[model samples]
Target: MPNVRPGEKPEIARLPLFREMQEEQRERIFSGSFLQVFPPQLTLFELGQHPDFLHVLIDGLVELYATSAGRDTTMRIVEPVTSFILAAVVTDMPYLMSARTLTSSRILLVPAALVREVVKQDCALMQATMRELALAYRDMVRALTDMKLRQSAERLGNLLLQQERRQGGNGAVQLKAEKRLLASLLGMTPENLSRAFAVLGQHGLEVDGAQVRFTDQAALEAFSRPDPVKDDD
Candidate 1:
């Protein structure tokens, strides 16, 4: 899709991040902001780049990633109806990670200066920001624990379980992302992901290209042995 400038704006204030903010503060923050469209694989920002805007994802998906020593890894995937990279915008520091579009996306870009000012003047917005940042931190810790504790195949199995739950427990998982990107998010090479899939196949997972179904979910649960602390959200 071609990138569209702010043409038809959505109800940005209705989103959770902006909902608690005062209308006056919301208007002030959004007055200078604009909605933008981005195509898949486009980089929104890179590590160490100073942030000028706080991006609110109105639709579609984004990938947060970091790289060093000539390699890159996916840190997290941001879904719709949420804001991302708030720390840099609030602290007036450079971004610690880069963001890229995983799908054609709609985003609202609020000026960094206005965001800071609104947060200072609006207590509700400040409380909301603090809550989001706290959740983000806990989420990072949970992800780290999952990476450190689980084996590659175990992780893949648990991920399938989580996906099933997320998609309404139909016993099928239609992957919304490319296997390569999923592999990166799993902290494994694509080849390793393939091998992991093959292992899960022996257990209960049925892989049909991007689609997966569980023939014996009980068996999968046995093999994965998901911990509530790590797997529960």
Candidate 2:
């Protein structure tokens, strides 16, 4: 059974899955779920553990990583209001990646069995989840393609452009992950990321700590020009 403190029900129900659910459904969910607060750097679940609960990140960020031998690679980052462990729970497999709190974070924990039951009965919930999964798949494809086809310099430049767009303009955009993690996400090593930053400066991308400024958008975009493919003809 999950540990439910007083006054947590309302907070838990405000999460996406419970927000749209009927009162009865919400009640059923709360009956089986609770909240957990993790301090910064805390490991929520280790790799290869069978995930018994679905985790909804309510605050701060969590990073997922995979390891072998003595080294590890960051697999993904989860932000607030997002959920994780869907694939593992749905497939009944141990988690392929371990999750750790990047900052102090609050997460709602619900039994995977209860969630499966709710998903089975609620068409809206099921459809919404499928949409989330689809977007995740698309992101994975884009990241893989970017890594395989683009030079490290181009990948770094493109990531700058993407962050600018995400921030609504190119003037100042902040990085959400640590430099090393961001390097991994962009499929570059830390030293390579530093070299790429110097290369970016050559192409007019200026870094100001966590914030990036595009001093010459045209030059940067020129350096990021797409390659022609047979399909384009």
Candidate 3:
């Protein structure tokens, strides 16, 4: 991993959270921050480890998971421009879940102590942190509701629809992550996911390897029954 040099200050300052902070506050945080690149499948932090840094994914994917009875359950996928394990960092507690890279990634690590100190001294920073925390909590609630109420097929259909929207509402959607990882994200076994896809095929959803096409969007939506309040993009 390479350290962030002084010349990269401007680029680092461009990050949403950092951009909202005062110059001095930003400096305080950046003084303790460094950038690192990791290869895919590298564990960035383990469960129960001390939250020494607030890690922000600059690019690439990160998986947050909890282990139980020797099996790992995926909790969330951290996309770029987002911070992970912030609640633990803010509380000065151990990380409740382990984080690992899903692809080669660039990350910014800001010392958690500096983050807490800056939040204490800066109202803007505190408000920003609160907003981020609130959004994350809301997302968790939605995910729980989805898992509780939706069947495996419905979940997969809704996910495809969301991906379609992300791809500018085109009828064709491509899977960015592997199907096995997608299965983990949806809280289903790979076999179950395959079955789910097969079931969805009856409702105008076509799956050919990583590519999915919707033959009848209306019919598929009717089958998926996506609720705006519950379905997060």
lDDT of each: 0.86, 0.79, 0.87
lDDT of 2 at 182: 82
Give one digit per residue, the lDDT tens place, for model 2 in 1-233. 35766588877767655667777867777778877778999898989999899899998899988899988888888888878967786667899999999999988888888878888887766776676676667767767888888999898887677667657864566888889998887767999999988998988788889888888888988997533221111
* Deviation of model 2 at 55, angstroms: 1.3
The best candidate in terms of TM-score? 3
Which residue pairs in model 1 clash with each other? none
Q: Which candidate is the best by lDDT?
A: 3
Query: What is every candidate's alpha-carbon RMSD to the true fold?
Result: 2.9, 4.2, 1.9
The predicted structure with the larger TM-score, 2 or 3, is 3
Task: Please estimate how well model 2 matches the true structure, expressed as its whole-model Cα lDDT.
Answer: 0.79
Q: Given candidate 1, what's the lDDT at residue 132?
A: 81
Query: Comparing candidate 1 with candidate 2, which one achieves the higher TM-score?
Result: 1
lDDT of 3 by residue, 58-107 (tens): 99999999998999988888888889988999999999999999999999
How close is every model to the real structure, measured as TM-score?
A: 0.90, 0.86, 0.92
